[model samples]
Target: MKKLAIFLFASLLGATAQAAEYVIDTKGAHAFIQFRIKHLGYSWLYGRFDDFNGSFQYDESKPEASSINVNIDVNSLDSNHAERDKHLRGEDFLFVEKYPTATFKSTSYEPAGDGKGKLTGDLTLRGVTKPITIDVTHVGGGKDPWGGFRQGFTGSTEFKLKDFGIDYDLGPASQTVEMILDVEGIRK
Candidate 1:
């Protein structure tokens, strides 16, 4: 009986020490979601989504168990030009009226050397869901001055607009869009 009790307590301790989950600090400007696409095959047009929220689970001891999920507000797209932004929010592009949000949920994590990894997940945009892989680099992680633990990462991926049903053509220039994500999360 004594040995069994000890074993159960040790197992509980090990489970508690395995992984920690963190909530993305969206309200504190800890995340940035931006995209860029070629314009007329000449210049790159850049834009960002103003509002988004996400959360992640990090297991330093078992990095393979880490995962992330994010939700972006589609109507908050900004391009620094009101006209262009409005058009992007219209039916020809994002169709924010119908699909007000985009989402990504990590399905797998493959670690590379030096705090880098390949994150493959399902990205849903414009009511279409597809698998996309992003290369992610862990920036750093530690306890913040505010008495909270934090972690950050930057990732990027490129995909064709037509894959997500955004078929608007701009003279063969807007076929592909490159998305970059910088995210920071606080331990919950």
Candidate 2:
């Protein structure tokens, strides 16, 4: 009987020490995935994926064990211009009809210091999967007035357009695109 009690206590402790699961607060519009690319080697074109959802696992005790997964609706991209947005969705660029979705699944996290880290993942875009790294920073965390605990993070990265099978080149200066992501997760 004593051994059984001790085993149960140890199991409870182990469960408490494990990572916390969180759902990205997309319904509140508190998260974003934005991007920018040079336009014709002269100006910049900025846009964002307006529809995306994801979840994450995090633990204060073992930050390196964190993980995140996101799915993006490629057709939901908005650049604030109608004609250009349509063109971007066509075969020359994203080809949204054939590839309507994109995704990112984090494989590892490396803490750098000062609440910042390197998040490496496999990004699947345009039916191509490639490894990418995002420089991430822990924005903040706390309990909200709605009686929910939340944590936020911001990340940025840049990759060559050709790397993701996007070969529609405007010019040499427009070979790469920069991406920025912000997420706020509510503990579940």
Candidate 3:
């Protein structure tokens, strides 16, 4: 009888320790957003956004309650080529002068097994907002040597630029672009 009481007490303590509120530290975190599109029906041209900021609250047990917010400067588009980068920010593409930033807000989450899930959110680009779903995987979360709680995550999503009014064409350049995001957040 004493052993059973001890076991229950230990289980309660373990559950309490597992529940923690993690604050995402933006400075300690890194986010990379990359996209690839078919260029001229021959090859794919990959590009990425260089400047962006985001934050998220995550709980492994209650992932559905997690929320994410992100902001990306449209002018930060980098295609590696100078001319292409400028053109991408021009009126023909993102039109950075009018809409300087794109944003995303997560609204729902669904489990996909093995620490992975589907996050559905509203993505706003070029003044248009649409619901997009991203595939997300939890890389793991733990404490750093310096005492910071860090969490790692990866996500991927895709959409067509034309759907958001980016109708510029580069001789068969695919309108659809596949996007991938690698993100790490630290407890605030």
Task: Give the clash count for each candidate.
Answer: 0, 0, 1
The C-alpha lDDT values of all candidates are: 0.92, 0.93, 0.84
How well does each candidate superpose onto the true structure, as a TM-score? Answer: 0.91, 0.91, 0.84
> Candidate 1 — which residues are off by over 4 angstroms?
1-17
- Write model 2 residue lDDT over 65-122, tens digit each, in one string: 8899999999999999999999989888889999999999999999988889999999
* Model 3, TM vs. native: 0.84
How well does candidate 2 score on lDDT at residue 163?
A: 88
Q: Which residue window of length 10 is worst by lDDT in model 3?
A: 20-29
Superposed on all Cα atoms, the candidates' RMSDs to the truth, in angstroms, are: 3.1, 3.5, 6.5
**lDDT digits (tens) for residues 1-188 of candidate 1:** 99999999998788667778899888898889999999888889999999998899887767777899999999999999999999999999999999999999999999997899999999999999999999999999999999999999999999999999988777776788999999999999
Models sorted by TM-score, best on top: 1, 2, 3
Tens digits of lDDT, candidate 3, 1-188: 99999999998787655545454444544668888888888998999988888778777886766778889987989999999899888899889999999999999888888989999999999999999999999998888998888888888988988889987776655878899888887776
Whole-model lDDT, candidate 2? 0.93
Q: Tell how far residue 102 is off in model 1, in angstroms.
A: 0.7
